[model samples]
Target: MEFNEIIERIVKSTNLSAEVLNSKINDKIAELDNLVSKEGAAHIIANELGVNLIDSDASQDFVNIKNLVGGLRNVIVLGKVTDTFPVTTFEKDGKKKQVGSLSLNDGTGFARVVFWDDSINIFKNIKENDIIKVINAYVKENKFGKLELHVSYRTKVRVNPDDIDPKSINATDKQSKAEFVDIVEIKPDSFVKCFGAIVQVYKKNIFFNVCPQCGKSIKSDEGLSMCSEHGKVSPSRKMFVTFVLDDGTGTIRCTSFGRDAEVIMGMPTIEAIKLADSHEDSTFPVDSIKSKILGKEVFIYGRTSLNTFTNSIEIITSRIVENIDYNVELKRIAEEVEFGDKN
Candidate 1:
């Protein structure tokens, strides 16, 4: 058990705020001339308060970010917030729902923490570089097969705990370089940058509805477009492109969203929308662009995930680097060769 967990247990038993308990623990530490550790002081305080700090079934402990896996429950973790995303709202079953997320790093690895509905209130108080302790949170694999920590009603989050030194928490940089890998080496839950040629394109269902205000997908409610954040409103169209990329070693399906899709199609989304309107065929935009895209070489930076229905891995492209740079490619190849030789 960690010192934070001990303090939490004492707080629960004594109905005391963590601040008050921390003050007592600090005084205890000072009274002993700094001879005892924070955990030792916490134990002494708990004993004086007549709080039972032991539990036979106490399995929850601080888990490192890298070791977290899907389907984990009652998890505890402490990490520094690296990035925070705005809260997004959507409608589900005619009710409004809000979700917010932040990226956390604990030096070992990085993970995303998702706050749902009421939990967004807690997320709102968090800021970048804040060291937060999360207790009773759950871990689940997202659609991309990446593990995410989800905060529920039972979860307790302490932001910048007094006993912890901010300097001691060294978080990994979120903008670290992505691994460069070939299509054959792509693995689920990994981000990679690869160079490939467009070999095939799926032209059907190239456009979808989105909320103009938030750019999130909007649903039809009783034949009316509804955005959870903005309520009923006019929706905008967003385009996505799906195609197969082959890098000579292997071929993998890839999907690019919005602006990235526009890059792949060689035209703006409005032009495609206009073309679709003129032809009265939604698939015509992609149909017209397919000939231009085939055999085009480009660099793809994206995340790989399993396509459950197809039982194969696919890439959700984050970026497409066009107009190939042969010099950089040669250097990357040389590095790969050197790495292989070292192995």
Candidate 2:
């Protein structure tokens, strides 16, 4: 957290003027023989008044930003506020829903946090470089293939505390061991990191109906398209792509949805849907998807699940990176499997 955030927090929490707090902070620094910075001095004064700085429990399993992946919940992250964007509003269910996004960096890497509805107000006055702590956050991947933290109903926002040392939070040793596992070792509903060749691309119902409101696929009941929660709705077409991944040990189908599907298609899903609709063959982009994605070794990070229709377990990849360096991947595989002497 920066000194500005401390000062702002102090003023907001105590109804004190910035000028008065600045003067007292300077005085405390002088009294302490210039031993502490302005922020440190302000913290001392706040402590003397029996006030808390940032409300974070030190016991939290706060990891570096780069370690964040999807399927994580109740995450506690401690990072400096690096960037903040303007709040934007969009209509949802006839009411304006406001959202805001900001970047938090812990020197290891930066992760974005999106504040929804009421959470946006917490960072409305936040400034760049303000040290921040997010409590009970959730992780999800955005459209652009980046993992992000989201402020939820249980989320709490805290500012800088005196106990934290920025130097101690350096990124030198915090890189993730989060690469893909071998294809044969995948388990149900677990996010697996693995790289394998796209041996085949499955051709089935690659497109489906989706409810606009909740964004889940709408089920067809007779002639009526319906959502389980929001019934009798107009539906939109969505992409549901599946492909085979081979890691020598075994092959498993990898599924991707929506934004990830769009990425694989190299075009917006809606555009693909339109092309499919216009074409008499109804197999639009099949050749293109096969040409680009198949016969390639791609890195995948996604959850594994059993496809009910096929009764076979498959990986649902959230993100895929193509044309990985073979030497580095082999090293990671060796470390994970202890493949050398096996002593």
lDDT of all predictions, in order shown? 0.81, 0.71
**10 residues in a row with least lDDT, candidate 2:** 171-180
lDDT of candidate 2? 0.71
How does each model score on TM-score?
0.45, 0.45
Model 1, 212: alpha-carbon shift in Å? 0.4
- Candidate 1 lDDT by residue in tens digits, 51-170: 988764332357888899877777888889976655667665678877777778878787778777688899999998899988888786533345677787778999998867888777
Q: Which stretches in model 2 have alpha-carbon errors above 4 Å?
A: 1-179, 187-190, 306-312, 323-343
Q: Worst ten-residue run, lDDT, model 1?
A: 324-333
RMSD list, candidates in order = 19.6, 18.6
Best by lDDT: 1
Q: Write the per-residue lDDT of candidate 2 for residues 81-159, one digit (tens) a residue.
A: 7556556676655788676676677876777787766787897867766778888887765445566787766789887
